[model samples]
Target: MADSQRTSEPINIVHQDEIWKAHVKLEKDSAEVWPRKWGFLTDIYKEYKMESVKMKETLKVGLPSHEVVPSLTTLQKHNHVGPSPPVPQTTQALIGWRSGHAHLQLEKYSTVHHGRRSFLKELGWPFDACY
Candidate 1:
């Protein structure tokens, strides 16, 4: 056997098919050989159930309301996960160069589509609707 490394030819359809088959076979083998990990929602429910049990035990001792753990909804609200932040008035009001370029393109698009006697009106919108 040669010690030197050798480059292979570019893959064609047959090679690609073989590679895909090998990948699918490997995944099947892995699935059969190992147990699947707990799903995301399952893990979250498990944690919530465990925490609820612990909290029940703690509450039996009559802990103060201030010391009680906050509910998930309360946590989400405080973390700004429920309601979205206000949209900026202009790209200049935003903090990044990418946003500026994006907003400029968006403004141009809106003007082209929403201006008075716009492209849609010129094309006879009601009649051209199907196309």
Candidate 2:
């Protein structure tokens, strides 16, 4: 096993007059916080929307690399709550786009899955409403 040492300097218990001292160095640390004006799930959606606009502007200027897009290149390197290996902004935007697309797919699927429920409701089959 690797040797374990006390974080602070060693002190002699036998010396009644000696004082014990421990020093801790302070450093800036990165932290994640919620932003105002947008919901959690919706924030990614908004990012996706803005990124798309920037992407169009990049194309208009004939930029060589899509990576030149500020939104794509501005991914945070150290987000405490982000995924391991660090997700790129472009990848996150794609994920947001896909997620929105999936919701549409689900709504489409509801026509099939909820057909019976809708039919029953149309026939006056009263149901308790709850969130």
Residues 1-131, model 2: lDDT tens digits: 22245646665575634332221111111112223423566778989999999989887766568656556335554322322343447865656454354343435445554334465477676566423
In model 1, where is the ten-residue run with the lowest total lDDT?
A: 97-106
TM-score of each predicted structure versus truth:
0.27, 0.17
Name model 1 segments beyond 4 Å from true.
1-11, 36-131
- Residue pairs that clash (backbone atoms under 3 angstroms), model 2: none
State the displacement of the C-alpha of residue 4, model 1, in Å, after optimal TM-score superposition. 31
Tell me how many residue pairs clash in candidate 1: 0
Expressed as tens digits, the lDDT of each residue in 5-114 for candidate 1 is 44465437888899999999999988775645536667789999999999898887765899999989888877642333466788776665334554334354455554
Looking at model 1, the pairs that clash are none
Worst 10 residues of 2 by lDDT: 22-31
Q: Pick the candidate with the highest TM-score.
A: 1
